[model samples]
Target chain A: MKRLVILAVLIVFCSSMAYGDAYRVSMRWSAKPGYLRLVLESGEEIIKTARVYHSYSLVKVEFQSEFSFDYENTPDAVDISHKGSSLFININGLKDVKVFRLADPSRLVIDAEIEKTANAKTVPEEPVKPYGLSDVVMVIDPGHGGYSMGLVGSDYKEKDIVLSIARSLRYTAGQAGAKVFLTRSTDKYVSIDERINSTYKKKPDVFISLHMSSSPDFVVYYAKMDTSIRSKDRYMLKYSQLGHLGDSVKLSRVMAEVLREKFKRKVRIISMPLPLLSSIGSAAITIELPDGKYFDYNASNRYALVNTILKGIGKYER
Target chain B: MKDNRYLTALISILFILVLAGGYIYLIRMHPPEIAMENKTEPSSQPVTKPGSEEHISIKLFFPEGHKLVMEEREIPRVFSQKKILREVIREFLKGPAGTGPFIMPEGVILLSVYIGSDGVAYIDLSEDLRRNFHGDAIDEYLLLKGIYESTISNIKINDVKILIDDKEVDTIGGHFYANRPLKQLVTQEIKFD
Candidate 1:
């Protein structure tokens, strides 16, 4: 009897072990003034790969294991598709997907902003007065803060140099009647998510990220997907979803031309799939400055670089 | 009294035997348990010989203008695919012989390279690649593209996945997402519409 009891207990324990690591998926959405926020809750770390079918306002979450979702009392009516170990959570009027991972309940939360519909019955809005470049809103992000020193030169830190340049650009751009915002105004560590969230929230007209390069020459980049040689048809370009990739490329070209003409430095414009540039709603470009012996920001040439960027912005709008 | 003495001696012998058995069990399990713990660390080595060296002609990619260009390079090649990838990357990091306007960030070190059966090559680099970025989006793009293109063109591998210090990185220089493996031959020539 004792042996039989032990065997029964062993069988139960072994069976329980089979389902030990099983996980489930839950979703919730809340309506805000301008957009809708959707949160997805899961037991394990949720996979980050997702595809948005804009026509259907659908988002497909790709995962490796079996999972289930909680559909009770959802704010928006969504179509749920569970096929071959993937979930397609489709909601009406989904515009953007911003994901956040919470540690408390181990939830993978997605904030999907809804697209606003045009109200034909409302009164026609009045035409506003014209302002030259005044309507242009710009966000100048100086990369790296606190512990993320970026690149450390022999004498100067990349964070300090870029921040100084950003400060100067902000003042210059503001004086030109444009509203400017900075990701970090001081020396503090901010995650990439916070920076992207802030930029997307602001929805600026143009976004320029500043960085100091350890390389000898300056570089400008927009957003493009890197191709894989081995991957089949799975690799796709992400810039199409960026929404501002066109503006980004155009702005990048103008900036490159102006910087090359003014500074006579080697400047190359390339496309990359950058989170800050591609994920944000605004037209974004990242400019890298040379931190070599000849490229000093404190010298008189600092203002020249700023003037060059300002000219590039003017050229972009024109 | 004699019966009590015999019982005591038998009990002591049995206790000693139990103690010896427990000690032997622990001794047998200790080494393997420690080995299991060590196995949890990052797989630092690849399934290839590191010291085998030969000569081969490989196609190298470099950043030229706004595009990546290919050049043929004849160098002392290593036998293993990982070593070959490492040597080629090191050569690219050393910069081309002529006035090529593109180079990776200074101080970036290649940690390890592991090619899987799925044709994806995991290239582990030091954190300096991320920490030492000086904010040039174009340079970052070119450097990453150079790595991707050079590896794929020279090696039989299909994709390049970058890891910083044996850990996955989200993005390098805030411009590109490094979380996924980059396919080879992906070009970013500026197209105006």
Candidate 2:
């Protein structure tokens, strides 16, 4: 009886060990206010590789292990195919994808922001008011604060420099008849999520992020639109969902011109991959000034810098 | 008999105290366990034994005065693409023999490299690369351009996706879009778009 019991226990243990790590992948999605959320629930952890084809506006995610798709349907992806051990999910009109994997429950969450044709930008041939910024709702975000000491010069930190500049700009821009909001007015640590959420919530018309860098030249960065159409597909260009890209580019150009006039040197305007600017859904740009050692921002100099930015924004408005 | 009972009670008290101490040491107040992230960090020595491995010549591009200067180097021949990439990246980080001021900061190591079936390579570098950025656009642009050019010249990969400390960051180079698939060839200076 003892031998029979021992053999039975050994057989059960071996079978359980053999089937330990096999799991099927179940996928489902739901609609949110501005974007859709895709949920991939699995018993096993996910190891994925994504390739973004900008011209096609499609993102393909490949999985390592061979798992059967237990769900029936999805909106963005159709005809889910398995090539050997790989499962590919092709998401169309994908603006950006933020993925999160939760522990305890063992599930993967994906937020997929889709590009819509309704978000196309219309830049007017001329400004509306041509005077003070009475109709502008602007948000000024200082780059770093608290312990994030951005760039260290001989005696000053980049955080302090940008904050002082931002504070001065707030005072000057507010005096010039613009309703301005600061993401951080003091020395505090703020996360990226908070910054994005605040900017998105406020629905500002123009957003300017200020910073100081060790770069020798003055630079302005605008948001890059991830979606693009094939060069031959001219008809598809109109339907492209380029939100805020046009206005951001125009604003960057305006700022570049203003800074060039003030500093009397070349100011570079480049498109960058800044999540803060991309998701703001408005005309957003980041202005990088030279290090503190080169450019001193005393009371008079601070006012001058603030006046320069205001001049740029005024140009952009009109 | 009384003495024997007292002795037994004292022994029980000591045993309970020992149990409490063990619990505190094992579970209550233990130090964090530090695990080695990458086991394949190249030592100063060659990957293989000196005379055992085959050698192949590769051209490495280093940032020299705003342009990438190609320097020929010989590396041990490895069977897999991942291994070969690791060797190449290690060599690139070591800088040129003449050492005319390499663009990258020191202590930057390649933690991991993963290449998917679609020929996209995910290269995870150490945190030093991200934290040591001094906000110089020229150095930033040249560093990435040189690394990408060197990798492409030796390998047949489609694109390279860079990750610092196993996480995707917004941008390392302030000018270019770091989040995008790095396929743009830098033939001329980075022009404003």
User: TM-score, each model?
Assistant: 0.51, 0.55
DockQ of each: 0.16, 0.12
lDDT of 2 at A300: 53
Stretches off by above 4 angstroms in model 2 are: A1-131, A146-148, A186-194, A224-243, A272-276, B1-54, B62-71, B96-101, B116-119, B136-142, B166-190
Tens digits of per-residue lDDT, candidate 2, B27-83, equal 545332111112223331223534656776667888876478998788867655676
Clashes of 2: 1
Cα displacement (angstroms), candidate 2, residue A127, comes to: 26
Error of 2 at A282 (Å): 3.0
Highest-DockQ candidate: 1
Q: Cα deviation in Å at residue B100, candidate 2?
A: 5.0
lDDT of model 1 at residue A257?
92
Residue A3 lDDT in model 2? Answer: 100
In model 1, what lDDT does residue A14 have? Answer: 86
